[model samples]
Target: MPVLHALKRIGVLFLATAAILCTPGTPGAPAAADEPGWTAEPATGRAATARPYFYLEGTPGTVLEDRLALANTTDQERTVTLRGADAYNTAGGAFAVRPATESTGAGSWISFGAAGTVKVPPHTRAVVPFTATVPPASPPGDHPAAVVATEGGREVGVRVHLRVSGPTLAALTVEDVAVRGKGAGTVVAYTLVNRGNVALAPELALRAEGRFGEVPGRGARALPVELLPGQRVELTEPWPGAPVFDKVDLALTVTAPGGARATAAASAWFVPWAIAARTGAGLLALGAVALAALFLVRTRRARREPPPDGAPVPERAGQTAPEHELTGTSR
Candidate 1:
């Protein structure tokens, strides 16, 4: 009876081992590639408001508080370094941020605690609070900046659209309107200058009046630029419909959001100089021939006509007239 009891106990142990080996995995374990990467953005508010970028406004010599959220979804921990960076527009007018070392504007005003770094665990998120203290003499208007995060060789930036609270202006000007090339390859070039103390998203309209009538003109369209305060950008638009042989007066009207508008104009002649030059040469040749003919006719008339009174006459080779002979009297 004791031997039979031992055999039953061995069978139960074998079953229990098989069940444990067949189990898939523990609960709450991370699945493969479920959360692949990480992200950096503005932290959500207590009211659960999702923000695209950080917008902070304050008067001069004030401090504004904000928080940044860093999320890591991978299986390992992520170490990210944070820094403030000044924002500006590229030559082509694309928004960009300066490197952390070169930040001097609103970027320098931001503070990210004692150590500007955060370590996020796998499948976890971290919130870091920061402050931006405006300088006492900071200028009014938009002081664009960003919070930059770096890990390994990759960098991600979150925009901080900081603005100093004061009277703002959004004025701009269109300058140096010019037409280049000719015919099918014509292009209209101009420069946009932000005269006010605020950034501007300018819309441009191109109109032209040719000698005959209204020529091809461009309707109002938003330019691919964000003109920063006191910043100017030179841009060109292709005009495939420019006239082939007409003098045109081009007017460029640029408008911004804050009741800002400006107009600049230029005149261009699209003559086919090759054809004109050939025609001009032909006309000059005709003029020269006509002038020469007139000279020849005048010379012939002078030779055929009698000499004026009191003019001396030339003597023949064998005869001479007496000097004392009187006119209309026989001697």
Candidate 2:
């Protein structure tokens, strides 16, 4: 029995050594159905075969157990390294496993009975036992992780979904909302932050009002985002045919699962300077023309009307009036 245990340990070491020694092949290439290779799957149990993921619901201070199956489909011996990593959704919304160097949350809470490595003979499989212990301080809601097998710089993983039972809160907020660009081509940008312990798929509604009245509002649109707890993302929406001149008031409303609602508002002024300048110049020209016409009419009226009766008549240089000659006694 001692010799058998030694042999098993040796097999595990060999698996670990192979993972480090082998050169990496092409990254993310799927093996053909008929090709000889290896695969990692969930062990046969409650929902392993159909779901292929460890889904356990437990409260804080609870312990759950599971198993993973590693298979070698080739005619030669295969070795690999077993590890655990946190799981997250990529930008494209695909489920992804974290790098081997990092582990947190559920990944750190899980432990395996087998060593870091395992060896499987040709056309054979190995089953490894593992356990997940929820900490007393862990928050409520879903925690996603994965168990992976690495060989020759390639990895295959199976998901581990651990849910800590408690009140699930879906709180979110809209922040830093603003409008960008001008005229008919404009966009509204904002940040969406998850403030609770549950994931959310949010729907957004954008409305804008000008000095005159409400402009065309963009109806609610569902965003293609799987927002995780404590994560924030910046996003933008098109505001086609935006008002060109006015004080615009913008508002954004976001709603998600569990009746989560948040709203943010911003104000901006849009003025077409070129058009305003032209309109002011036209008004000034019209005022000048009206003033000139008034002046001309007043001058013409003074010339056409007779002057007030004069107190004295004017005298010529060589011919003076009789009254002036008699008073001066000289011409």
Candidate 3:
């Protein structure tokens, strides 16, 4: 009877271990590639989650409530700092979050119920409730933000997409354009500004013409910059093989998403000073020689031709004109 009881106990222990090993993990708690043990996500709230980002839409003066989930998959506890920041596209066109120290626009509007710092036990999640209040005079468009978590020098975040309800205006401007240098070593500089309430990936088309309507350099290229709302960036484009000696008319046409367009122009004179100086000197020398020849020709003609009726011809030192010639009478 002792042996039978021992065998039954052993079988029960084996079954219990097997069951524990076969259990599945919690849904949506999968670890990310960059952050192996930490993950931040949006929790259940008035906002809707479409995959990895949260979408919240409301009118001005409205308050939207949401929650952020910070999960720690490691065996040790992790202390993470939480904050909100505005989101924007990188130069490579990838979506990214702003720095923790900066909290403007949608980032400033977010308020959390818990402290800025939170600690989560091993294999547990910390839920933080947050509210985003839209200002009464907020512009209508998309305002992106994120709830970020930083732990042990590693940071993870979940995006918050806020759309204010009103008319959407997309405006942009190009200003302060100029052309510098000469010939093949020229540069076209300009300033691109976003005047509306949205981001822009601007496309540039450049055209340069000489004084005689000759196209010296023309091209269309896309800039690797993401201009944010109310932001301005000074950029330059290399213009090789530009005209060497002519008045150049440089025009830049910038276009972006949402039908934003602007055109700016600048004119510059590209003169080779060394060559111009040499040519001018040669012209002046030729003019001096031509004036000297004209003076000699007038002097010789006066000596050969007869004097006018009332004009008197002066006599030489030891010679005198004949009386018949002086009286203009035939001999």
Candidate 4:
């Protein structure tokens, strides 16, 4: 089979295996509500914008995972209270299936920090972490949920969504992910590590996978990489555009080195932030030093001998004042 086709087949099998591994009601199944919260402006009080964009997923009947962040851009200090966790089914369309108050915020199914009122100071943000699982008979599609916040009697909220596209036939894993920042942009490097116990080859491709970044493979180098169980190699992915985040995950696909088996991939984190921040700070320091040096030179010059423009008046050191000639001439 052609490399691409083989990879497609491998991906299909991987999903199939995942679906099988994740029965509809396995304790670890994807939660009835996978993701919870609006991506951007959760309410009209503010525009749509998730400070730290988030997404979640898990096997059917398995554990759910989540990460939520809130940013403060308002002018005044406010108190944020969380409530109203509602779940929904988005398979056919928008449909509410569960309430925010159900389930205990409970168990590993719904992990929350302190379910009560949490103070969010001005100009700061916070995160709410959670998890969930699907019931055995829940029909598959997209499931969603939300966490609401109330302040000054006004409410702001966010939503999360999860897609139950069935299960995986094989365990698909990715590795060696890395990123480097270029002014307003970044460079990512990574390699695929195939850990499945199958002699496989798959095709690899990537798309928008991180918080906010663009990937261009032109100068991107996909190495003559091959993978075996426990095998890995480094590959460099070029990101030519500015990303909106310090770190983010991406989505893509890859075949085994032989290009026989292919698997679809969701991204992990790509962090190019620390270096960028350091580089920016370093440049700023250099500029400050240069300015300081210039100032010092000017100060020293001003205190030292004056320039030609400020030359001293010449004078005869020993000449006595010339006696005034008193001859009065008639004009």
Judged by TM-score, which candidate is best? 1
**Candidate 3 lDDT for residue 309:** 97
- Which of candidates 2 and 3 reaches a greater TM-score? 2
Give lDDT tens digits, candidate 4, residues 6-27. Answer: 1121211111111111111111
Q: How many backbone clashes does candidate 3 have?
A: 0
Ranking by lDDT: 1, 2, 3, 4
- Estimate, for each residue in 102-124, the C-alpha lDDT of model 3 and write its tens digit: 66779777777566888889999
Give me the runs in candidate 1 sitting further than 4 Å from their true place.
1-36, 272-331
TM-score of the candidate numbered 4? 0.29
Could you tell me which residue pairs clash in candidate 2?
none
Query: RMSD per prediction, one decimal?
Result: 18.7, 10.6, 16.1, 22.2
Error of 1 at 111 (Å): 1.3
Task: Assess candidate 1 and give its TM-score to the true structure.
Answer: 0.71
2 or 3: which has the higher lDDT? Answer: 2
Task: Give candidate 3 misplaced runs (Cα > 4 Å).
Answer: 1-55, 65-76, 86-104, 120-129, 152-161, 181-185, 216-221, 271-331
Q: Rank the candidates by TM-score, best first.
A: 1, 2, 3, 4
lDDT of 1 by residue, 62-93 (tens): 88888888889889999988888787665555
- Of the candidates shown, which would achieve the greatest lDDT relative to the real structure? 1
Checking candidate 1 for backbone clashes, the offending pairs are: none
RMSD of 1: 18.7
What is the Cα-based lDDT of residue 125 in candidate 2?
Answer: 83
In angstroms, the error of model 1 at 22 is: 49
Clashing pairs in 3: none
